[model samples]
Target chain A: MRAVGAEEVAPTSHPWEIQADGLVVRVGGRRGRNAVNELTLRLGRGVHGLLGPNGAGKTTLIRTLATVQKPSAGSLSLLGTPLGRATGLRPLRRRLGYLPQHFGYYKRFTVREFVEYLAWLKEMPPEAIPGAVQRALEKVGLADRADDRLKTLSGGMVRRAGIAQAIVNDPEVLLLDEPTVGLDPAQRLSFRELVAELGQQACVLISTHLVEDVAAACTDVVLVSEGSLVFQGTPAELAAAGTTDHVGDSPIERGYTALLSAGPGRSGW
Target chain B: MTAHHPGEQLLRQYVRGDDVPADQLWAVEAHLESCAPCRGRLAPDPIAEQVWADLAPVLDRTPQMPPARSWLRHVSHWVSPVAGPWLAMILLVTAVAVALDQAGSVARGQISLVLLVAPVLPVLGVAASWGRAMDPAHELTAATPRAGLPLVFRRTVAVLAVVVPGLLVASQLTGASLTQWMLPCLAFTTCTLALGGLIGITRAAITLIAGWAAGIVLPTIALSRTSVALDVAATPVWAAVLAAGLIVIAVRFRTQSRSS
Candidate 1:
């Protein structure tokens, strides 16, 4: 926080890479609830951890940012371009990488082939795909398994494969929903390091229930409950918001429960 | 990464916007990138004038791209490995039909088995290509920018590319006229796509195939004559149906893009 002086001398004064104003997204179908309802938030370069309980609209919000779902009402934009413009979203999609909560993949494809295929989908240059896929696999510690079929991998390796494809394009905005769901403790550590490195240039959003991951790697924490913002600040700030009064295992956990209790919706847990 | 560094005079020429000969330019650029101290020793670039002069040509225009290997990857790009099995099934069914027609299986006056199977061959392929249960990457693919009509049409073309030729050969062998089968085949495929845009592709294909069996193929097979749907009088009607299906597809995509 004390580095404000240095930031002022930086080239661009605009820091909000992702901006949303009264954003509302409907998931499921026409009868579905507004999963992301009237939410307004801004994010910049650095890893932002999205923390919310199940059914809190974390996945829905992540889907909207990934451009998989359209906002039913309100305004949303990415990298300074408001979505739904006449220019089209194809250009923006090229600069974005996303990993869904379920992370569906073709079992018949090898690790390298799958990542390369996704690179083609993201529309990377053909000449650049081979090297990019190699580097992404190496980053996720899957270089040796690149030739192996996805069906032959362990659960953690499949998750790493998903991560590899998500990063193959070196996207400007990376959205990962429940990315660490199947990763083991060791792989999760490496995953956090990789995410921190990516956050140097891209606006990386990690939506998960793991407060420990947020505390260890995230530069900022965003707490939402029932599709509304409960808190938005640094991890340290989130910890300080709690006391002995709240019930949780860790400081961040206590802070999370505290904020949820104060919010409009009650987190059953 | 080398231990040696470029001379001060050469570095100065490189930094001051003066021409550094090609012989030395590559070595100097490579060295400055790896050696930060040599970079710090250089004069300032307030306007990045040196950068503009040195790197402009490379940055201004992209290098020429290699032409796509139109024979190989062009097919693989639009089709998945899963399509291999489904396409094989379509061809296998076509072979069976051709065999049955040659054997004089029912009677000389009977409808050729080739015409009975041609229309629905692609319907099976289309169904397999887009079926959610069949493709594990369905949701992931939908997230990409090319996921909608572009993907649908690509797979459609890929399926057609295989089955169309196989059907052509089979019909030719069975003494069936091209116009008798080709137009209805196309019309049925387009109708599947049109209804696919509304109810979903897999369901549309199942409904159309079942309808073809009930209303057309069954009666033709039992009566040992050509069905009214494939009769010569209905040729212009098939053309109209094909055109209408295409319009529906276009209109559906337009309204979808608008509402989103």
Candidate 2:
């Protein structure tokens, strides 16, 4: 028999919105001590809400999307650029905004200095720094606190500053991890409006287990479970996917619980 | 009359993730599959041309032949931090060595302490270069990609480029000829910096301290013998060999960290 040699295969295509046919991630912790599997993401616009229990790879997926963590297998692209192929990520970073779950801010820096520094890192020209910093502060409703040092800001205000740095670049794609984590009700409402404003311009993906924020901010919902997408639909669809008896007015809390219990691919929420 | 694009509604539905009837989703997908402009937006821009353009200027700007003496001048400028203190210490030590050597030379001390202290310059020169190389800020700075390859290499090369001339000039000022020791001194200084950078700033400090003790103390001990061959300038080839080994390890460690 004629030897059948290695077959050529075409590469999978990735869109700005995720087109991940299959994605797998295995990451070793700093000293290669621990490994965790993170979810695979495909690209698209609008706010995609991520919901899962703790240690379910919600943060992991967000980090992977931000290009801080590499997937063990499968492909991903953000704003149309393949992760590895792009050598200098500065330009991509300029277009990609992120509010990590936690970040260290220089306590001595005034709000303006911190935001201006991030803008400089994004290579925003000297002239645009002031305007960008002000616009970001205004968007986050922190305009009054612009002159205050980070050490002087309240907990909620500090969280808002984190958000202000994130969107200062006006990135094409934005990922906010637990944006409402430490916010009071009033601050959460204000943050929601800012997210809505940003959604008008870029892809805004918010990962949080808190269904209320998802209900308030997201137009689309992505339920991740056990490192895989369990449901990808709108809030209404997600609610409808819950038990038929409570379908119509099913609250996000009830729907989110239903989705997780039904397990991966069941989509019962 | 307002114009209504047929695809506009589907686009809105798509963004909202609405459960559009299957027919509409299929039609939009079919249209997108064949549309080149739409498809191109979904793919990453090719970067080969951009990489070429960015690198071209840097390569072009590099000098074909820098002034032969420029490297010496650069080294002199760099060794200032350690050289300043070392020169003061050496002046004090040199006076002592000269007095001791003169007295010893007159007596059974045919080998002067001046001759024993000759090895001091190269050892101190290398130590100075390595000390500057191991600056704690440089280690933390290296951890960030912002410093990039060129910046890291430039800083490392900058240290090396500065130390050599400093050695040459200091030797000239002292009215000493480095006919045989020239290459070894150069190798020692360059290698120490390379090693210091490789093992990290802290480790490099420890290595420099150990090297200093061995350089001065060991040479004095060896020259204490009546044998004229044991003078500082006449260090066994093994000392140079050990310095070379340390330099190689330093270079290897530096390159490994850079790559990592």
Candidate 3:
């Protein structure tokens, strides 16, 4: 600990908020390795939205945060511990939730069964399994149909169930990848509400192409284009960066497209 | 003071399963629930209600075994479909062959080879296809922390469990006395399973066929002192050696893929 008088010192002790320092991953193979260069980010509580075009590596970044895929070249820390180092992730996993863009469940499993399974994977104590299942189902509004098998559920319902499982453990950090992709309008609204509510207690990272979701639900935005983060700021700040002549139907869309197309040195693309 | 929001109450009722109207329910009861005040509340609550309705089904699903179980299950996925029927057939053939051998018609050596190698063919075929099946689509959700090992191991375990038992039954049915064939059967099965795991199933099959051909042809052509029957008895030892090598290769390949 540094002296109390020192401005650089943390007064007592501080936990590391999630941090990523210079991540690089190459997907595909020898024909031509597609390089994804990810910038560093340290996020605290509230909803942080990751927005970008197709193949922007938003999914890759989310997977890395979830510890599902390792970064080819970088160090990532969750709560002050490096990822995949035998010790850190196991415990951190108990406090982490992830919703992949494409999720699959055992077709034979019922909704309740899937969540219970996830709860088990999350390493929740035996006694808390049922309660956790109930609470998570209630939060996602799935308690009633919990007895129905997954194969019987509609696509939207499946997606909702996926979200419920992701949040079942009440993770401190929740990473969602295109979570509302298949939802009906009403379902999407409820999911957005759930994200907003969950954000109050945890650091939630929502990765999606929909600007409206980021605009309405997220506290901040991280925009990635061609595997690089082009911008990071609030909605207003993001809007300001795109307002050229100051008149457009939807500045967010215009700005995002502009950013995606801009070459090496240009700002925010 | 807040007026009871009928919609909120209804939404809660729906979640609780109380609002699901039965065939015998009174229209009055249903109507009491459909008033404008209730309807207005239900409109805003629909989104939440729908979300819960959708997710409720997922909560009913079952939990799978942990990492160990998962590995076993995945292995079963590969093994069961391809190996199960073949094992059953092998057992049936072995029973018939054993009956014949007991009746004193078929040779012991021929019955033994058929019983041992027949069931393994299907497993070898499926195992070889694994290399082809290692497509990007078969890849599990990359969002998991396990680095695909759990997924790969699960499939492997399930396959081995199915294949091993089948081999044992076939050996018994071939009239190979349990006391005589048990250890060798185990050794053979272990070797083949490990080899199948390492090289593509196709290569394992080719190796098996080539070994059998060489065993029969080389001794005959060279007029060797050792009979093919004796070489057959020593087959288990060869499998054990091959299995050890495959294990090493599989481990190295797995580590290399992950690091790359």
Candidate 4:
């Protein structure tokens, strides 16, 4: 639950890595309802936690950030490059690392091979791959199991492998959706440490339902409901929104319930 | 210990952005990890500073052997493990068709079952090579920067690599001219990809397979003769189809990949 002030981190010369302005993403069909509705956010270098209930457009927003899906309306930019332009997004994609909520893997690939393949996809220099793969595996504590095939590993280890692939390229923008789903408590602690370390340079956005995770790791928390952002601020600010009547085991959870009940239209810090 | 470390000059060269050899750079990095004083001694240039910032976290670790040998690595990129059984099945089907032709049971007049089935073999292989339903890693693969045409083409080449040689051998055994099936085979494969960019590969392959079976294979069997499309005289037409398919695939690839 430690928060690093933006002033403590070196200011980035590049524009916000993720800037979404009045972004609207509709799913189903042409007249489909909004999956992400008029959401706007600007993020730089830090760890951000996105919290919401099921069907709150967290995954939709993450997919859009990953550039896997186009917004039905509004504008988005990654690394200062505007999306939906005639110019290709490869340059921005090359700098992105994404782990989807339902991460898929080639079961036959060894952990090392999986990470290396992702690095290649990211267009890392060929010579730098071996070293980068090794470092990424080490960061995720999967170095010992680097040679093990993905199918042979436990679920938690596989999740760790997903994280390893995400970081293999040392991405400038990292989007991880529900990264701690299968991890044990100890692994979650280590994952938090790793996220803290990555936040020093990269803009890290993690989408999860675990309020404790948001409380413990996030420098800032964004709360969204019904496809729109309701709150954004430091974890303490979120906790302050909690009322004595709110039901939760902890301050962050109380804060979560408080804001979620209060719903959208609350001003962000 | 000597005051001047052996890596000092190399580290200086590294900082100056001189072309330091990989091993020398590695050595200097390894030495600097434990040698804080030497690290401080190296004055920072912006380029070198950024390089170090990026590399310092990742380079000090012990290097592991690359996950696969170069050839295996290339093969893995081209096809998945599930592709092994699928390729084997394609070969087996070709062998069965060759056997039936040799036995004279499935042969209708001059038409061989092998010839009838040859054009779609690579299509089946290409279908198996990619698809959201077929590939367990499709989601992860799709999210990658290189996931579109390049990947699709790589898998297609891999399929052709296996299916083409098998069909060539089958054709030799059946005494069928290579042009009778090769051109159409190439055409069908390209068309699968060309259509795949729009409708998806599995659907394209299935549609092509169903169309060929109904339009050519069934009619040729019913008439006890080869279809005109598979005739040696149709080589030029097949060639034209192949060319068009390639053009479509190229255009579609450029548009789809650019949009993605």
Highest TM-score: which candidate?
A: 4
Scoring model 3 with DockQ, what do you get?
Answer: 0.07
Q: Rate the local accuracy (lDDT) of all candidates.
A: 0.83, 0.60, 0.63, 0.85
User: Sorted by TM-score, highest first, which candidate order results?
Assistant: 4, 1, 3, 2
* Cα lDDT of model 3 by residue, B4-70, tens digit: 3435555556546575566323432454465666555446467888998998887657442222235
In model 2, the Cα lDDT at residue A89 comes to 50
Q: Which ten residues in a row have the lowest lDDT in candidate 1 chain A?
A: A1-10
- DockQ in order: 0.24, 0.04, 0.07, 0.33
Q: Residue B122's C-alpha lDDT in candidate 2?
A: 47
**TM-score of model 1 (first chain only):** 0.92
Task: Report model 4's interface C-alpha RMSD after superposition on the true interface residues.
Answer: 2.8
Query: What residue runs in model 3 are displaced by over 4 Å at the alpha carbon?
Result: A1-16, A84-88, A244-248, A261-264, B1-162, B177-260
TM-score of each: 0.79, 0.54, 0.64, 0.83
Residue B203 C-alpha lDDT in model 1? 94
Q: Which prediction has more favorable lDDT, 3 or 4?
A: 4
Model 2 DockQ, alpha carbons vs. true complex: 0.04
Candidate No. with top DockQ: 4
Evaluate residue B63 in candidate 4 and report its C-alpha lDDT on the 0 to 100 scale. Answer: 51
Q: Which 10 consecutive positions of candidate 3 chain A have the poorest summed lDDT?
A: A1-10
lDDT (10s digit) by residue, model 3, range A1-269: 11222522434232545787777766664464434585777787889989987888888788777876657777778766676554545556677888877775667667877777666656666556677788888888888888888889999888888898889877778999999888888888888899999998788999998888888888888888777778878876777666565434577766665565663348633
Task: Give the lowest summed-lDDT range of ten residues in model 2 chain B.
Answer: B136-145
Supply candidate 1's per-residue lDDT for A91.
Answer: 63
Q: Give the worst 10-residue stretch by lDDT in candidate 4 chain A.
A: A1-10
lDDT per residue as tens, model 2, A31-144:
542122334456577777887778777776777767666666666676656665434454555567777776656565677766765665455655556667788888988888
Interface RMSD of 1: 4.9
